[model samples]
Target: MTPPVPSVPPASQPVFPLPCGMVLRPWREADAGVLVAAYEDPGIRHWNRPEPETPDSAVARIRRWHGRWSEGGAAMWALGRPGPDPAVGLVGLGDIDRRGGSAEFLYWLLPEGRGHGAMEQAVRAVSHWAFTDAGLHRLRICHSVANPASCAVATRAGFLLEGTMRGALLHADGFHDEHLHARLATDGPVLAEPAPGS
Candidate 1:
């Protein structure tokens, strides 16, 4: 028989702070509308094709992420400043392989939230937590090679480019090559965030 997933302590979600009035916090039911709206972006929908139909269904999806967290399966975080409406994006881990001591990291931000280095900082914070707090040894991230912005983020977060997997990811348009980037617990700190106004 297969052994059960390891027990990480049952706890509240963590909020990681970033500079310039940005933070990464837990997702809430109220954030469903933002999620729905973000997905409605043609770019987002083209890349991420999960369909649950409406904002209400999006809440179910968020709850499902929390369920995975409770089971020590993955950790998910929402991005925004601390306020009534705090979900501008999401960053999370998936396919956590305990036996392999690794997990796949993913993230997305609304168009308005772009320009600032928030995503890079968020990714670095999450990687550190996964290595130190979560006791995971390796984290891997991959994005469509066509998405240079994502590739830049992964590199800035100190994920080393392993290689390109030909046509590894599919979107609304078609298949695209994926660039694999990974970081190990023993790896050095991630690339430094750019100074404000750079």
Candidate 2:
């Protein structure tokens, strides 16, 4: 007989809180339009996300994130703002492997939200949550070396630079070297200075 499906809803998610007034929750159907617009960013299109995405396509991808959560494979949260403000960022653990106790993490933000130390705040919150609440031993974050902004976010969240993998990630622009960073459960909060006001 086949074994029963494994489940890990406890680590899968709930809402995660961040400093300077932000939170990370599951993606909503209403977020489709916003996601599509966000992806229109040249940096986002060139560095992250699937190529050539439409609003409908964004919705489909968002749905898939929900599926990932249900299957206990990933925790893709929609970064939420305070009061009635729309979400300005995103942060979550991808490639969640329970047996191995490691996962790949990622984050991105809208244009207006850039350069305010907000993503750093979000990253620390998500990483701590993953290492603690999610029962993960280590979290790995990698990005194309060309993206120094992502590297900054990773470091600010306490992820130490492990190494660079040559041609490790393939995108529409072709293979790009990746900077690998990692944080372990035993690590302290290496938060970057001065959390910005909301």
Candidate 3:
């Protein structure tokens, strides 16, 4: 189904700052290598099932992400600290149904980006933007049931567990049950702290 026109215009995606010097910003061509590297990590590969990526394919993927934003179907961001070799992770809203006031969250972090609560912070930041700035009323975070880390992130971000979907995602290992978690605009605040400049 078609999403309604996005409240956040395509030309102006906002950057959100997290604690400890991280930020969620739009992906750049220079980030293609990082995307390729993420796909190389066993943990990410096992969970995300990314196609083998050459630099060209990674750049194409980044451009497609930009197009999705322009089409008002998604908003994707690269997670990183400012400086050389910035993006170490990715987080975003996908499958957005703006008319229905809903979207799904997607994310992953590299080894360097892990263990710092960055994923949880990124989720909260994106959820805040989805609800407040994007005019979305509901957001979902669904992951393979085996992915307890994702479950924790979703829960910490205030997305209540709704239920499990049988065989919802097919991983390289096999079909896996998926846990569905959701949060509403009216839900109590889950942010550990206000987003920068909030």
Candidate 4:
């Protein structure tokens, strides 16, 4: 008699939420509009690859995110606040190196969602989840030097500015220096608790 084969359990889905009352969940078809609005920001377009941004393109991107999630380790999530209309931005850990247990972090929020601590909180939340759930030892966040806001976000999220790569990326206008920042799992949570009776 042949031995029976056991079925493997399905992989677990990971979700992270910010203290600011936003939840990081899987992207949905309806997220296209909010995603387009967020990507339309000049600062976002300046640092990352240009997004096609049509409804079809958004669906395709969401499908890719689902595929990546199924594969494990590498993942992308839509940042949505708790409300009828959700999914305000996108954040994820990409460029995973299993051997080194490292990955690159990426994120963007809608223009209206900016100026509040949303991005910073979201980054910390995602980083904590990535480190704990994915067993990532380190995460890198690189940005163009011209984008100071991104640099500030990295710093606020407890990433250290390791160094700069001269002319690492060529922007629409010209070549620009790249600022490399990193956060280690050993570093613990970036957002500290409020002091007693502040």
Candidate 5:
């Protein structure tokens, strides 16, 4: 028999705050434009499938993301600075395996936000929350080898390179190998410890 669904948390819950002054909160309808703009970044398009993100499509996608949270399988959040215009990016725990206490993580930053360390901060914050608040045991972050920036983010967030999946994703260019990085609940420093002698 399939297991009972996990209880859904209240709507619009605040997940956690990143050190770089952003908060990860539940996605809202208002986030569609920001999300679409972020996804439109050329660097973003280079790694994943292109998003056909018209306003209507964004609205539908946001609704679907929210619905998944209610179903107890996945959670998506907007990452932004502390006040209004806060959502400069999106992050989520996807491919949830509640039975195994594991999940996959995905994230992207707005074009303007790239290279600002925002994505790294967001990844660390979300992974910490997933391992703690969400009671997850392991989190995986997979990225195409062509996207070294994404690999850098995973490394900065303390995810160790676990392995590579040969030809795991077929992009517009061609099939590409993907590196799978992972962090576990038992891993060091939930909040990212300073390097030795820092």
Candidate 6:
């Protein structure tokens, strides 16, 4: 006889709290404008190469994120302060391979989200959830080598630099070499800074 479909446990999606006082929650329709603005920002657009976005399109994208979660393909969150302010960033896991126990990290921040360590904090929170709660064996974060900010965030998040993938991605300028950073579930807590005196 054929085996029955594997049973999956029911659980609610989690909202991660960042040490920098920002929270990562499921995307809302109201955040569509922020998403559009993020794509319009010159810095974000140059690096991320996001598709053109409008209010309606952004809402549709958020809906797709919801659908992707239900399909076990992705989990995404909007990063924002605890009040009524709009989301200033996006963070999440994409290209999830349940059977293989792996996923790729995706993120981008708006202008208001820059200048502080918020992205790093957000990455750390997501990594923690990906390893412990999600039960994933491996997670990866890839960024264009030209983007030093992303490199810093990945490193601070405890993802070791694996290697450079030549012409791995095409940015707005041109094909760019990408840095591959990965963290295994076995890795300990995120690295901490040394004491002032050593």
* lDDT, candidate 2, 1-198, per-residue tens: 642332375644677666656777778777787687677877777778645667788789888988888887888877867545666767888888877788898778888777667777777777766766667788888999999989987877778999999999897789999999999878875444543342
Q: By TM-score, is 3 or 5 better?
A: 3
How high is the CA lDDT of each candidate model? 0.81, 0.76, 0.87, 0.75, 0.77, 0.83
Instruction: Please state the error at residue 109 of candidate 5 in Å.
Output: 0.7
183: Cα error in model 3, Å: 0.4
Best by TM-score: 3
Off by over 4 Å in 1: 1-10, 190-198
What RMSD, rounded to one decimal, does every model reach?
A: 3.1, 4.2, 3.7, 6.0, 3.2, 3.9
Estimate, for each residue in 1-198, the C-alpha lDDT of model 6 and write its tens digit.
Answer: 642332221245688777667899889999999988988899888887888999999999999998888787798889999867899999999998876788999999998888668788788887877777667788999999999989988987789999999999987678999999999988987535422321
Q: How well does each candidate superpose onto the true structure, as a TM-score?
A: 0.90, 0.85, 0.91, 0.86, 0.87, 0.90
125-177 per-residue lDDT for model 3 (tens digits) = 88888877788988999999999988988887778999999998899989999
Q: What ranking emerges by lDDT with the best candidate at the front?
A: 3, 6, 1, 5, 2, 4
Clashes (backbone N, CA, C under 3 Å), per candidate, total 0, 0, 0, 0, 1, 0
Candidate 5 lDDT over 34-107, as tens digits, reads: 75775677776777565768777888888998888877578788887766674777788888877678889888
Better of 2 and 3 by lDDT: 3
Off by over 4 Å in 3: 1-10, 194-198
Tell me the spans in candidate 4 whose CA falls farther than 4 Å from its real position: 1-12, 194-198
Prediction 6 global C-alpha lDDT? 0.83
The residue pairs in collision within model 1 are none
Model 4, residue 27: displacement in angstroms?
1.0
lDDT of 4 by residue, 1-198 (tens): 642221211265566667667777777778877667666777677778657497778778777877777766467777777665768777888877755678898888777666557777778877777676666788999999888888988987889999999999998889999999999989976556422321
Q: What digit string (tens of lDDT, one per residue) describes model 1 on residues 29-108? A: 99888778877877767766556348788889889988998877888899887777758888889888776678999788
Clashing pairs in 6: none
Best by lDDT: 3
